[model samples]
Target: MLELRKINKSFGSRKIITDLDLQIEQGSILCIVGPSGGGKTTILRMLAGLESIDSGEVLLSGQPFDPTNLKEQEQVVGVVFQDFQLFPHLNVFENITLAPKLSLKQDKAVYTKNAEELAQRLGLANLLNHYPYQLSGGQKQRVAIARAMAMNPKVLAYDEPTSALDPGLSQQVADLILEMKQAGMTQIVVTHDLDFAKRIADQLYQVTPVE
Candidate 1:
């Protein structure tokens, strides 16, 4: 389980999250839903090691989780940004394998196989040669997901996954998330779409910005 204990965050004098506590069970999907600027994405960023909390602690499986520890964070959590940040210069295959190739430093064949399997599972097998700009929004989003999954993190978090997709595509994403959950990957989703949250989350958390 992942637990946030008395978490507090602020930017200058403006507080964002204050005295917040949350627990995320393993192999479960937890959706954080709220209005704009409610610090939902900030929580994901903290998990991704992109942001820092002013006070409190993050614990994963009863062990201390240090957000400043890049290596530890990389192994524990994977994040999919709202913008689906794919490398414009690299093709789908390259984009998906680049991180593992650089970070894992294992046999190229191992990471290659993992990337291929992820692409196939996410329905990007045919688009391996395609660039981000060449694919549609949904395809790009899938590629982003595949890239994150390639790292095989224990927890995956997404920020506004369905913001750019229509209802049909949103449902498809929801299904994919559920499939991941069945595979024992714990997920945290930050979205404003309550309907999408209801469709996918095993638990719902409502966050409001601290004034």
Candidate 2:
């Protein structure tokens, strides 16, 4: 389980998240939805170790979670950005395996096997040699997901996952998220689409901007 206790965050003089509390069960999908500037993405960033919280505690499985610890954070959580940030120069296979190679320093064979499995599961096996520029939006999204899964993190978070997709693609993403849950992966999604949230969320959180 992941728990946030009275979390607070700010930027300069403005408050972003104030006294926020949340809980996510293992192998469950949590969807965060709210208006713009409400700190939904900020919450995901904190979980992904990309943002710092000003106060309170983040705990995973009853232990404190430190966002500042890069190695620990990378092993515990992964994030898929809204823009699907795949490298233009790297082919799909390279992009998926890069993090494990750089961060974990795993042997080439181990990472290769993991990458291939993730690609096959995500339906990107046939496009392993293709660059980001050559792929469609949904394919790029899958590649991003495959890359994150390669790290073997227990928790995965996404920011605005369906913002650029058509309804069919959005449903595909919903199905994939469900499949991940069945595979024992916890997921947190920050999105503006209420319908999408309703379709996949095991629990829903609404973030309101701090005054």
Q: Where in model 1 is the C-alpha error above 4 Å?
A: none
Give me the overall lDDT of model 1.
0.89
List candidate 2 stretches off by more than 4 Å. 72-74
- Residues 11-115, candidate 1, lDDT per residue (tens digit)? 899899988899999999999999988999999998878898789999989999787785722677888889999999999999999888888764789987898
Alpha-carbon TM-score of each model against the true structure:
0.96, 0.96
lDDT of each: 0.89, 0.90
Candidate 2 local lDDT, residue 170: 92
Looking at model 1, the pairs that clash are: none
Ten contiguous residues with the weakest lDDT in model 2? 67-76
